[model samples]
Target: MACAWEESTKIRDVLIRPGTENDCNTIMDLIRELASFQGYPYAPQITAEILRRDGFGDNQQASFQTLLAVDRTTDKIIGYAVFFPFYSTWRGKGMFLEDLYVKPAHRKLGIGKLLLAHVSKRTLDSGGCQLRLSVLKTNPAKMFYSSLGFDNLTVDDGWETGRLDTNALEHLLESSGLTRS
Candidate 1:
């Protein structure tokens, strides 16, 4: 299914539209750029093929959705937002924004906000009550998000984010004798 933002949603010359399989490569590039900008200790493991398979493949329903911000004059992808739906026991339905990124050259142009607004609108349209995301402690975008009404759960609710990498997950599964079917 094609996702489209209303014509009135355009910001300056940037247009937000649904991403397709053909956009996977560009999307992967942007993801890498974001990782680099954030000074990640390790490079991203995701590849264009993986993105295409999981997000635009013919075999199964898309696990996530993406929206691309394109510069109308150049028709180049300057940014993108990836999101997926999740159920929150306390809030009912919610949308988790996995990533929101814009090229350094494109910053402060309102593209990022426009993309986020589009995602928020989509979440609401789908019967979702909240939009959530996690940002690095040092990312300056935290202020931007705050200005847009995103609450920092860590500060407000004393929540701490946790994760287990592939190796740890494998070790846990082995210790628990959990075999993948």
Candidate 2:
């Protein structure tokens, strides 16, 4: 597969920027491409409408923030990264990089590295203590993450990550009659 372009067909002044309302579509396209590459493409039921509502809707409080690497001339996005804040209980506040995807066709042109540096810089700017991410144990991404200075959190496989959703928490609160008067 051809790697990243040294110079695009015409889009040379590529820019990496924070996601904006105008980029919602481009971001979704990248997300789909990444998911497809990972072999899970979107679930059978999801749609573009759901993506906008869940991810870009006002008042949405999802943990992740998205960034884009775009080619200015052709206006084609080459890659993206998404990350979020996390609490370490002991390590205190940190960042969890939830997704980092560089289209295979655009790999190795420093886009991935630049995207990571962008994340690390933002983490420090936000007062985060450290940056962390999880990768499939068998995936080659561990190498990329390690090169970026992420120490593999070698916790004994005994402790697995936990997840909870707003709806679940709401149910618990209602069942306990803990709503504020």
Displacement of residue 90 (Cα, Å) in model 2 is 1.3
Off by over 4 Å in 1: 1-10
Report the lDDT tens digits of candidate 1 across residue range 1-181. Answer: 1223433344668989999999999999999888888898358887899999999999899999999999998999999999999899998999999999999988876789999999999999999999999999899999999999988899989999899999999999999999767
Candidate number achieving the greatest lDDT relative to the actual structure:
1
TM-score of 1: 0.89
lDDT of 2 by residue, 1-181 (tens): 2333433432346578887656767777777876777676773355556656666778867536878888676678888988888888887887888788888877756778778888888998988889877776766777887776766655544546668888998898999989946
lDDT of 2 at 90: 86
Instruction: Score residue 116 of candidate 1 by CA lDDT.
Output: 97
Q: What is the lDDT of residue 69 in candidate 1?
A: 98
Model 1 weakest 10-residue run by lDDT: 1-10
